[model samples]
Target: MNTDSKKINTSRISISELMLPSHSNFSGKIHGGYILSLMDKIAFACASKYSGRYCVTASVDTVDFLSPIEVGELVTLKACVNYVGRSSMVVGIRVISQNIQTGKIKHSNSSYFTMVAKDDDGNTVAVPRPILTTLDEVRRFYDSLRRIKAKKEHMEDTNSFDHTSREALDRLSDYGAILTL
Candidate 1:
């Protein structure tokens, strides 16, 4: 890790007691939606702290279940704000399960959640977030930013397919080249 990055705070919060119905499913594993809801809560908390405002989950790219948490076990969800962009933040969440009796802890799932901050009028708002606290974290955060930039560029390129002189003229006919919804 870079020395400067190592000095930064990478604070995280943990939530215990994620409940699941014992009779919910086969193999008695916690339902994925149940886990997702827990993740959303943790992610929101992380983002709210990072943004210092209310935040909502905008998307969940992927979630993988590596193991199962049986009923009566204590499920712990740890979440951290891993990256940020204008008006958006990405949170990393890891779910671990502990057997209530034996106290054995095992990894259960991992997910990345994207959240967006909003103002009173429901407009998206930007906020400062934590600085990277490790070389790995810095690299990952920058890589995610690159991906976001590339995605935006890709969208612009796609839209260019329909961009033409005549189309531009037609756009002006509407309102000086402004797109009206």
Candidate 2:
């Protein structure tokens, strides 16, 4: 067990920007890629703050665009370090857009980014453990642990799966198409 622990609140980061036309798609709504860029930026900041070292994104999970953001709205991205392992931290990001005139806000996106701490030579480095200060923070840590377990199970299943097994072929038969072989 690591003796060092850092408060979750110390790793939180938030940034808000006005959605401009240049950030939108042809349909007059903010582009998903643009939102993802902001998410990555905030995730990096949050993880770096928590780890006290340079961090790089290992994987991006659960990027769900809940609603479309209008071009003239104010978009905000909030990120926090939800979980930490020896060298990795899970950064949870929530994105919301508010209509400045009407004051109506909508949840536009939520995502999780796994970042790994790195040293000056680009080698992985260990990060301090998170000190969960509140119930909500504890719950977030549990959720991240669950997600990590599920991901490992999924990878194990995928690695051992036989895609062309009789059972798999039979399942594909539900498409109402005949198999060539």
Candidate 3:
């Protein structure tokens, strides 16, 4: 019944930067932590742009590094609002690296960041619901819904499951874990 909704396209953001030696780890590859900082920045921007309010990161639901980024490569991060739930929005981000010289591009990472709109007083505020306009938008929203459900269920199980139960101990043995407990 809420008429304050925005299309998915209006919440998209992209940023690009050259990976420098300062952003590299000891392994000579771009640091994952550095990339995560940029992701958080873009996710906040996308969520705030869509919600018309300040947004803070609630959690990073997923981050997968598929390829290592080199120091000299140009890294581009794209973020979009995939789903919205009351005060929260799931921002999907994709990271790509391009060899500026060879023009080869690599998909380095994909991640989901959950952001919550907030008021100036630091209280949670309602966000504008996302209006899915395309098939891809619909698919992304559904996928995020499923992932959030699974994460909640998994957390519940983890919180209630007995780690010292007989079956649990037996399963640990299968993993060759030496239990000192």
Model 3: clashing residue pairs? none
lDDT of each: 0.76, 0.93, 0.93
lDDT of 1 by residue, 99-170 (tens): 988989999988878899898888899767456657877876776677567767987889876655676657
Candidate 2 displacement at residue 19 in angstroms = 0.5
Clashing pairs in 1: none
RMSD of every candidate to native, in Å, equals 9.7, 1.8, 1.5
- Candidate 2: TM-score? 0.95
Q: In candidate 1, residue 3 scores what lDDT?
A: 30
Give one digit per residue, the lDDT tens place, for model 2 in 1-181: 3568788779999999999999989999999999999999999999999889999999999788899999999999999999999999999999999999999999998989999999999999989877888999999999999999999999999999998889989888798968888
Give the Å error, residue 114, model 3.
0.1
Worst 10 residues of 2 by lDDT: 1-10
Clashes of 2: 0
Off by over 4 Å in 3: 1-3
Runs of candidate 1 with Cα error greater than 4 angstroms are 1-11, 18-23, 146-181
